[model samples]
Target: MVNNNEKDKSSQVTEFSKEAGYYLQKGVHCLNRSQLKKALKYFRKTIETDPHNTYTHYNIAYILSRIDYLKDINETFQEILGTTYNLPEASFLAAIYYSLTGEMDLAEKELEKFLEIAPEGEIMEEAREMLNLLSGEEEIYENLSYIKLSEKYEGVIQTVKEKVKRNLECPFFRVKMLENLYQLDDDLTSNIIFLYGLAENSTIAERVLRHFIKSSWAKEMHKELAMLALRDIGAEEPYEVMMENRIVKVTLKEYFERIPQWEPQWYQVMEKALENIKYNKYHSKTMEGELKEVWNQYIKVAYPEIPPVRDINLWSAALEYLTFKKRGINLNHKEISLKYRVFPEELLEKYKEMGQALSR
Candidate 1:
């Protein structure tokens, strides 16, 4: 059923993809051999041909970090994370980047994400050490200013109470100190976790309580106590539910200061639409931010009586189309919808709805 012109076009596209794959393999091989310059050479070639390849971009970010070219690494890192949510290595690297930059809150949050998702590996141990380092609780990993002070059961407990009373240490340090003591005196683990849970850093407390529940260091009773502490803190995965569909674990409040009062579905739909943009031609960081701004603007006027979506991909593609249209780019809606696996008619309908929503 295909015509000669379509076949030729498909053949050229396949050949181009093959060229990109060849460069990617060469880059990986050179990287494995510790040939840094050659690896970068090939990786750059891969990016030129297949700019949206996630692993190729990740390799470049890794190399850039290794060579101390960190100025633009965050932008590169965030772009990769946007496309691939399950890549724990990016999160681990991002955490280290944040720590070096003195953004402890972001660093700790990234490390928690890495620890939660990364399976058993050498990186897992390193992530734990990084957590300790970020908290200034250990003398690990080079000659960092932080040092491990020796602890005795009685002395450590007394120090914890005295610090809590006098406010000698910050909330994070106080929690880490209690964690050390919890290891020393298993019998008082519940009491220690209770103190730890109420340490004012609810985020860190919620994180470590779950760590205790999973780690072998905590006894069964200690695990129960950790769970109780978690409940007392009242922190749960997915602080809110999306009435439109399934659950998303992230709390957008961390990302947005004053989250819109719209239903959670709009947010989830936006995220799904964004996810659908990964590895495509529309996956630039600037474009992603612009699309989000578009969503925010659209939702501002459309909220409270906004339309529901059965196909988030169609919504996503239409979002891109609408943004292009607003920018006067004149992208073909039919072609865009086909690329996103939706009907042309449906995409146009959604795009019109979005435009009208913004008008109101």
Candidate 2:
């Protein structure tokens, strides 16, 4: 039922829409790569090409909000909301902007609307917390260090206590939580020692041994476990405090014969030893020489394509490159890469190629 002029206009509109879609895809790709300036440019082009596109407006608003382009953010967000788009994400962002600007009433209203629209949204928990905070139902201590520590450690303490009270036999879980707590505050030496005593698993014991070797509390409360752990892990150093405990010495000797004597595979051993050394931990030094020898053997066997290099620096690079190629893990040293005039993007592409080849 269309005339020739109308048909030509329709064809032109279709072509423009296709071009706009291409620009939109480019914008999204740039955004994903964190190229904020390029993304904004492409998005603005998309707006020029297709002024009625709500998604383009939303994305531009999001970028502007992140960059604190406060003058334009509200207008852009309002444009998105004015459209027929059901944008709960926009509402959430608007709420955050309002909160930042000290417009509490507006922020509360936007958050409430966001909840009503998307009750099971990704930011629901954060929204609820913010609402509680805004309503003064929950206290947010700004300057109290003790209150902050109490808040941080309370959940861990409560979970462990509840498990203990219920007579739940999840030693692994208890020890894992204790390990996290220990990492948070090494001053919780007594608490960790108590939990370690109750758990006594080999994994937990090793973690405790690595972290608390110098702790007086650990030596006083967990001497037996520490001695047994060190012995199991083939530690050469003797603990003076543990040696003074007659029961610990006797127990250590009893368990010494039962510990496994097998070694892990060369690659795994090399990785673990290197990681420990990287962290300035000396627990893996006994295997360093053997690990270097194994690395040479591995390079000779697995990476025949790479030329042989005898220098430790070149050897390290070869090892890191081959490991990355084989396992898709980025073991390449950033400083070394800079020395060699290589870039992270180049390494990423190499890794991607390796992954694709493996998939084939």
Highest TM-score among the candidates is held by which one?
Answer: 1
lDDT of each: 0.56, 0.46
- CA deviation > 4 Å runs, candidate 2: 1-71, 76-87, 142-325, 328-360
List model 2 lDDT by residue over 173-205, tens digit each: 545545543454433443344333333344544
Tens digits of per-residue lDDT for model 1, 11-44: 6565555567656655545544555556556765
For model 1, what is the alpha-carbon lDDT of residue 130? 63
Q: In candidate 1, which residue pairs clash?
A: none
User: Candidate 1: where are CA atoms >4 Å away?
Assistant: 1-165, 168-301, 310-314, 326-328, 337-349, 356-360
* RMSD, candidate 2, Å: 22.2
